[model samples]
Target: MSSRGTDVEDAVDSEVAAPARGTGTRRRVGYVAGLFGLLLLLLLGAVVVLVAQGSIAIPIGEVLRVLTGQDAQSQLSRTIVLDARLPKVVAGLLAGAALAVGGAQMQTLFRNPLADPFVLGVSSGAILGASIVILGTSGVGWLSGLGLVSQLGVTGAAVAGAAGVLLIALGIARRVGDPVVVLVVGVMLGYLAGAVVDMLVYYTDPDRLQALATFTRGSVRNVTWNELQVIAVSCAVVLVLSVFLAQPLNALLLGDRYAGSLGVNVRRVHFLSLASVAVLSGITTAYCGAIAFVGLAAPHLARGLLRTADHRVVLPASALIGAVIVLVAEYVAGGNGLTKTSLPLNSVTAFVGAPVILWVLLSGRARRQAG
Candidate 1:
């Protein structure tokens, strides 16, 4: 690694380890447990409110009945809750958790606070892959007009695209051995991928663009239960895998050499972590259309609230916070009955993300490490 990289790792290691050493174990445990409990309750409340406040306006009681497998007062209410809002709400939940966990892993693996699938170009690659499939098939019709088989093809293409960018980024990072340079490279790759996508869009028939449009702005409303199965299975497996990597990731904070000395296979950890991030991000983007900022912002918020950088704590906390962020953003972006016209999920997410980016820049953490 470069001197700058080493310096940053040392700084991060100290900052991450100090709090754990200084605090009382019981007090920290209690705080973590309480925070987790509050987050779960908050998540539940968000789900209830989101389900209750859509266009049809189901009552909270009725929403609960539908959720708990009880009968609703009306068939319409049950249908709306079951067939319409429930899938969307669940999609938001899963997408948020997936992105946040992916973000947390990216930050650790790259040792860059700003690192994420969206910023690092992984999402763009997925977009490009999906676009190719969508536009290539536009000779027939838009994605919505296509059958389930074609949709699966698009999802597979997206995962391939994400994996492509990930491999390229990792290769360059290994050669450069500099976090800042890798970050810049990732950004450039994203732009390159985006430019290619734009060129494709420019040549394609405008009618097919309707389906492609949602791929850029992000949305969970259109995800069907079938797509949810793929997302749930992929995210669940990767999330559980992440739990196993927590200790190795913690060891890694101390630097690769030290981690190796402790018998952590740095190479194996990197492979697994990168693979997990690629899968989490690629799948989410394939279904949700490249949602942004949740992956970048949620981890920081988790670390701040928990006052630790341990992946075990940060990972789950980030997932919960991220889910809440998306759900709330969804509500703001026309999930509420008040808005007749809904905005894109990205538009709402940017409001939350831009401020966080500004704070990270103004805090001089990145700059200080680079210097």
Candidate 2:
């Protein structure tokens, strides 16, 4: 063949052998879409089961009907599902999603598999902020009697405390330039926050102690619609912000220096990501009482199931998985009538969370990542 003809043939072969980049992109998009659809279905099924299993024991069909504003089996069924169970179910869903998203961000930003809102002591800071208000104002009225104003006050306090701790952690992280050192620092900070909270509770009036204890232990059963509005608004806004963070966080997975080289603005991204975590974790801790390991476990589970750490898939998947975990825990922890006495959410969450922690450490993911 002539030289020009041979070059033309080679070019044609190359073009035939390689897939178009757009086609690969579309295939990935479709796979992610299917994954999200499956997760949404699982979350919906969980919500139905949780709503149906409470003291009233409505059927899933009745629960769905009531939710859709259609007729239930009876007016009483409607009242039970709508007026009573709906708020709690919704609270669990929002709080779970919020915490899980926060944890996923934390893990990526810190580049530590075990990083989470609770581990960083953000929740403890939130609890401390809440305890100060609750215990400080005990003479005025118990938390149950304090109206919307007090609710808002407590929520504000929690957010402030969480943000404060987050900033401190990030500052230290910047100084040390070591994820392991920063993780230890965060744990110590959490201990300090916990100590402060304990001391505040110790001096608190007996009447206020029970309420404070309940808040610390965590429960969604008592979250009223009024409370849900605060949680829903704050969590929804922050969750949307987290969506924008996905791309920046994905870059960060390659390490800060690499991410910075890619124009990720490492410092700014860290600030924004940590801020989102503060809002999500703080508000959730305020309303639901440090619901525990959902934040830590859900993100890891999402990554494991999806087999990717790409924030786009992991973030939403973590949210759905977190929602399912919380709903399931609520059901098992006496959100259902299967047990006479209700258990705190942490009781069940610890089951999922503790194992994951051990696995991460034992498998050397943490050591390898930190190294």
Q: What's every prediction's RMSD, in angstroms?
A: 8.2, 2.8
* TM, every model: 0.90, 0.91
Model 1: per-residue Cα lDDT over 5-34, one tens digit each: 999999999998888777768788999999
After superposing candidate 1 on the true structure, give the runs of residues whose Cα lies further than 4 Å from its correct spot.
1-23, 138-142, 365-371
Error of 2 at 24 (Å): 6.9
Candidate 1 Cα RMSD after full superposition onto the native fold (Å): 8.2
lDDT by residue for model 2 (1-371), tens: 69999999999988966667667778878887898898899889888888888766887888888889886779999888877888989999999999999999988877777889888888888988888887777434325767788888888888889998888887887788788888898899999999998888777777778778888888888888888889999899999998898998999999899999998898888888888888888788888898887888999899988889989889999999999889889888998787789988889899999999887787796677789
Positional deviation of 356 in candidate 2, in angstroms?
A: 1.3
Identify the runs in model 2 with alpha carbons over 4 angstroms from their true place: 1-16, 19-30, 139-142, 365-371
